[model samples]
Target chain A: MRSTRVTRRKLLRLGALALGSTALAACAALPTGPAKPTGEPAKTAAETTGLGSQPGPTTAPGGVPVKITFMMWAWSPENEKFERDRIELFNNSQTKVVVEPLIMPYEDMWTKLDVLVASGQAPDSVWYDYAAYKLIAKGQFLDLKPYVDNAAAMLDDSIYDQGFWKPAKMLGGDSPYALPIGGEGMNLFYNRDLFDASSEPYPTDDLTWDEYRNVAIRLTKEEGGKVVQFGTSLAWLQSWWAWVMLLWSRGVGIVDSHFSPTQCTLDTPEAIEALQFLQDLIYKDKVAPDPVQASVLSEQGGDFASGKVATMVDGGWDVVSFRSIDRFQWDIALLPKGPKGRISPFWIGGPMISKQSRNPDAAWEWTKWTAEEDGQAMIAKSGQQVTWLRKAREIAPEGAVPEHYSKRFETLNDLAPADVWSERWNEILDKVWNPEFDRFWKGEITAAELVKAIAPETTKMLQGA
Target chain B: MGRLARREALECYLFISLAVAGFLIFQAGPIGVSAFLSLTNSELVGTPAWVGLRNYSAMLHDPLFWQSLKVTVTYAVVAVPLGLALSLLVALLMNQNVRGISVFRTVYYLPSVISGVAVAVLWRWILNPEFGILNLLLGYLRIDGPNWLLDRQWALPSLILMSLWGIGGSMMIYLAGLQGIPTHLYEAVEIDGGGMWDKFAHVTIPMISPVVFFNLVTGIIWTFQEFTRVYVMTQGGPSNATLFYGLYLYRNAFRYFQMGYASALAWVLLLIILAMTLMLFRTSQLWVYYEGSVEKA
Candidate 1:
């Protein structure tokens, strides 16, 4: 008995020793860095990655040319290749300035950029589509108004539409901070086979919300007491963009007319009606799959991509993915109009000059070149997003688009790019409003209850800044 | 104190220098930094401004902090005991002299070896309301399954169930404890007219009590820190039903850029975990049976 007791105590001591060592190992394995900012330590521009690099030509004074670091959020192999190719093209085309690419995933982009700007190591130029106001508020971006005025003959404002250029003026003051390069507008993509199978006429450009809902219900298929197919799915419901578009279609914006952070207009009758209609589509009408039901098709492809959903509202960026769908015939149309009129949200991707750039002239030259027809044409050929420039839109590479794809451009005519690029916009939408809206989606609250519960808190967050 | 002993001590110090440096730099340094940061207001980019105790006061008034605390406690309370019990049961089953027992042990341990993200993604597919294999099996009995990840009422419980699946590590620990028990004790129990249940209760339970305590403490700590599955599967959603404290801290730090508040949250978590562990150690003397120690009372 004494020996057994001694053995058990020894085992206990051994276990403690083992656990202590295991914990030490775990501590050693932890990544060395501050949390939150998902970026490596800032490095000089001379470091070339294994992917590729080209040294700048000796053109400037003292036989050393100005070298500028150009970074953007490009993660996919194809996107990285495209960005690298564009860098090489730009570097080869000019001798006065050299551009190097610093690519990273989209999620890491803002965090890295914020750190860079704060540490006074910001790249000379960057391409970003969100959080414009945060940079503008910090005075981190160069005002391109003077550059644009000086190069008006070269820029030629008539080449771009009003909606395409509208988002560029997101600077707190009345100066353009970014020049538009590529963008897309929301469009309704429908499976022709599903409509034919349901003996329903194909949807047209001017279809109203009611007509769209009715078509969805008619196209929904159920057998053996279980729904095998859904009529429609929202392309990106998790984003505030869907809600914003829905509200816009009803002649209201999510924020106040001034896009003030301290106020939200989502409590209006039109907004409520729009939200309620979306809710009814899921719970009341059952035309669309709920969140869980939708996740099943996520692995293979999303609902519309996998042919489980007959129609979905998506942007032009989805064209590349949808084009690979050999399983069915699909095409695009305008989003359904609300009682007021037809309206869709537009997203603009562009390049902005950093305020801390040593070579501001070189940066402006690069930014200006990206908006030109040649740069826009490269984007058009990629089929990732529609080029906003008119000539690029008209002369997009032939194989890049499907037939009748010009309708995507036509839908951009009355595009309403909600002034949602303000600082605290993402913070409020993600932290304050999203969880409440999620509750509303789960049927725990009505649309009225949701907006009422979320509005004051959202206002508080907006005012916090 | 002798020359040989001094030489041996020098070798020990030399060998352990790397580990000691790592601990100070990676673990202790970050902990001290976070403690200091918890007293200040800093976004990731800006100069930290001293705001002593403000972050703590903010946490007191924050409803989400309380909700996340409740959720994490609920998860730990449910998952820790359930996981420990399931692990012990599996260990007991695997201890039997059955054919291909090693194969069974390996197969059971496979899930623990898989990455958390892969496991979460696999479980998400299994828990899908309409087309998942779980619901498909449930349908055979004419039972309509609830949406596992989507339903507010079922989401946390579903995550708890997922936690129960990766108990192979604990099972192996219990197996080691079970194997270490002397055969003479069981024989003595048998000689005293003890049945299997009596032997298990009097001998097996006492012998494995320390292992049980170890598993319980570790399981509780792990459950309190659960993040990856909740993030990959539900993202603390369907109305923040699965908002584990770790996930909430991550959101505060990364998503909201509230590094100061997140540091406060981290320190609070540390204190809570430390308190619980210390309390467990203090209380462990009452229930955990040890052999060679002097008897109290």
Candidate 2:
């Protein structure tokens, strides 16, 4: 036998080999494909208590509760707790089903859901917004119509607010895919202190476009050759969805049809005028900050809450952040009426059962429950969001900081679903619409030029050309 | 074969088997999968249908794809050379024997060690038009600084400028190479009636040509894959001025769910980098000099 000598070179090589082998083994041991669902049935409350009327866990025939996952994106700690509490309530309300909450960050929710879906480990139900139309087009959502038909008493159409229900139905096309839980409507948020300081009357619900602009100009305060306080801010104008509200209020739809759009109507004179109005607020009037300035203001502190701006057109959900503003008195009002009408852009979202759910019946029960009085009551009581159920909105907990917080529900009649309801919504916004609007905001291109440039491309995209 | 030689070869195989297996499984496997995926219409869910070169052909008509490629290539073109020059200069400065030099070196390299996202967030504030330090300094000089990330004309340039913050990484490598140069070579240059400039040009530069070459190649590759900073900061916004190729690929894969298109984009990026590296190697003979090696024709 030959004697082996240990050398530095051999030792280094052996070490590397060991490291490499360990890595390879680890990689080999890594799980592949979808993970098996970890929901082993839990014992039923009914088996122990034998009381059907009492609030207890319901179970399947074998005395095991069917487990389902509910995925939701929470914007804040309060929102997360609200969702967790709702899930806990539902879990305790029945003996047949158990719901596991999967809370994700709002920004990452869609991307994470896509990954979960692709891996065959998707949650049984997902809280979705207008973006859910893409999933509906792909037939990824279970048709809630059948579930609703079967659950007439629990999930009746008459009980829902048509403003949200209509869009929810439109989102699903021929069949309803989601049950309307709650929605956010765009409104005018004004700092009452600034209004008083400027000797301007508080904005009324009926303020027209011209009146709104004049008010903004009047309220604007300039000192030492610098605009100390803007009369109004176009902070939300950066989003295509937000600016499109101006167009909608002006009776200028981006597309000819909302349901099945073919031609892009954004090149119309009305649309250009609407967009130009916003552009003028920044350049011509200088009463509002540009996108860059708005971002800077936001970075420093809350733009409106910090008393930098007199008024802003924002969503009802902003109340959550505004509630923390103890320095100034703020209130919500209807958005300034455009040339056409007072059409407010409303973003409605709700729970959608995934088509691939293992226990779809259990998922449907969860979905149905969210639309029922209990779920809407939870939304109303939280004051973090507005309930879409007509009955629930009537009983909403009042005296929230905004004082006129219930005014959000009043705009339901004038609500238009935000964003173009197309499966290619994100693609159109990211590729064509946003780029042109960004240039327009930058003063690189006029509103007319921006609209014209994007119209043809947007039409082509909508047509799926 | 002789018994000793066979034994040695077997020992070498034993040492390398693990590495070869790892490379084959992880790197090579993904490369192959992506190549195949590039030829399909995978939405990352459901069955991916075979689309042949449809995704690549789609690139021909995709304006954003071209814009992203232009942005990435332009970034590489400007950032790589500038970074090399700056890092090399810093490396030369740090190579000097001075008091508290290690502290300076550590301070200079600190930014490079910071998390990319954290650095990006910090840069976002530093470049803000209103409250940013850069704009504040410009204000002091009575010059109105352009909105760095918000202005289309300035966004890409701002990112390129931000790239310099991490030059400490390459600077350290150059510093190592600078220190490794034999002091006798500098003395020889001096003995031959050469001035400081001559000593640097002939001795120092030639001695560190390999390090320069290494930095040049890596700098190009890294600049071409610039995504994290742009993603965290601008998100390829302000009219898509800072849309790097990597960011676009990421948008396609994760945002748009066009995995096949993203896979195609990845392959194209890989090929671009490969061609660039190969071109550098082919041209290196003219400038890159090695010590005690046969001169290439």
lDDT of each: 0.76, 0.79
Compute the lDDT of residue B248 as modeled in candidate 2. Answer: 92
Q: Where does the lowest 10-residue lDDT sum fall in candidate 2 chain A?
A: A43-52
Residues A1-465, model 1: lDDT tens digits: 345555877989986676555443333212122222111112112221111123322235675667878879876888788888877777776677788788998857876776566446778889856654666655667677666655443345456655666667665345777877777887888888888888888778779989989999988889997787788875474456765777877888777743334577788998888888888888899988777667766755888887878888888778876777888888888888887788777778888877777766666656666666567777877777777567677666535455668878888877866556556666676567768877887677888998898877776766773
TM-scores for the candidates: 0.84, 0.87
Q: Which candidate is the best by TM-score?
A: 2
Write down the RMSD of candidate 1 (Cα, Å).
9.6
Per-residue lDDT tens digits for candidate 2, residues B81-150, read 9989999998899988999999999998899999988898889889988889999999999999998888
| lDDT (C-alpha) at residue A446 in model 1 | 86
Question: Could you tally the backbone clashes for each prediction?
Answer: 0, 8
Off by over 4 Å in 2: A1-67, A76-102, A153-159, A170-174, A372-378, A389-400, B1-27, B193-195, B292-297
